[model samples]
Target: MEEESWQSITVMEDKNGEPHVLQQKVKVYTSGVSEESPGYTKPLMKHRIVPVKDIVNL
Candidate 1:
């Protein structure tokens, strides 16, 4: 399972339109059932900062 969080910040406006910066946080959960043994593992988390336009274009 995965979870996500987002925050937006107004960085600047270009001739086209207003641009925004985004702060994104992601959490990934996995079952710790490996060859070694079945165990409990902490969730993995990641953070990223990107431009809104870049995502929109993609």
Candidate 2:
């Protein structure tokens, strides 16, 4: 497998189990492609990644 262009620095979840993307002060990877555009593998969420803790709680 190839290395991911970007990775989740940190992820935080809300009480409702909804992911709260902390986009400030954190580094997110970008291939410079818009999500609406084609061939975009990046997630459209505001956060880089969601931790397993969030899923378990939710």
Candidate 3:
């Protein structure tokens, strides 16, 4: 089965020129004999959205 883990993220940006997390999804899989193959358990997901209030020039 596939190992349960979090997805790696370096940087995330939104359409309003803001950094945020929206509709985060993760895949949970059942254990298998090998790492190559794994079974899915269910579709687990989440959602979030944020807007930039101000922009600062650096």
Candidate 1 lDDT tens digits, 1-58:
3334454433655566756564535343445454455433333354455656676874
Q: Which scores greater on lDDT, model 1 or model 2?
A: 1
Question: What C-alpha lDDT, on a 0 to 100 scale, does residue 54 get in candidate 2?
Answer: 46
Best by lDDT: 1
lDDT of 2 at 13: 75
lDDT of 2 by residue, 1-58 (tens): 1123443455667788866544323233444555444342444434444545543565
Query: Which 10 consecutive residues of model 2 have the lowest summed lDDT?
Result: 1-10
Q: What is the C-alpha lDDT of each candidate?
A: 0.49, 0.46, 0.48
Candidate 3: lDDT over CA atoms? 0.48
Model 2 clash pairs are none
> Candidate 3: lDDT of 16?
57
* Candidate 3 Cα misplacement greater than 4 A, ranges: 1-3, 6-16, 19-27, 48-58
* Candidate 2 segments whose C-alpha is farther than 4 A from its true place: 1-9, 25-58
Error of 2 at 52 (Å): 14
| Number of clashes recorded per candidate | 0, 0, 3
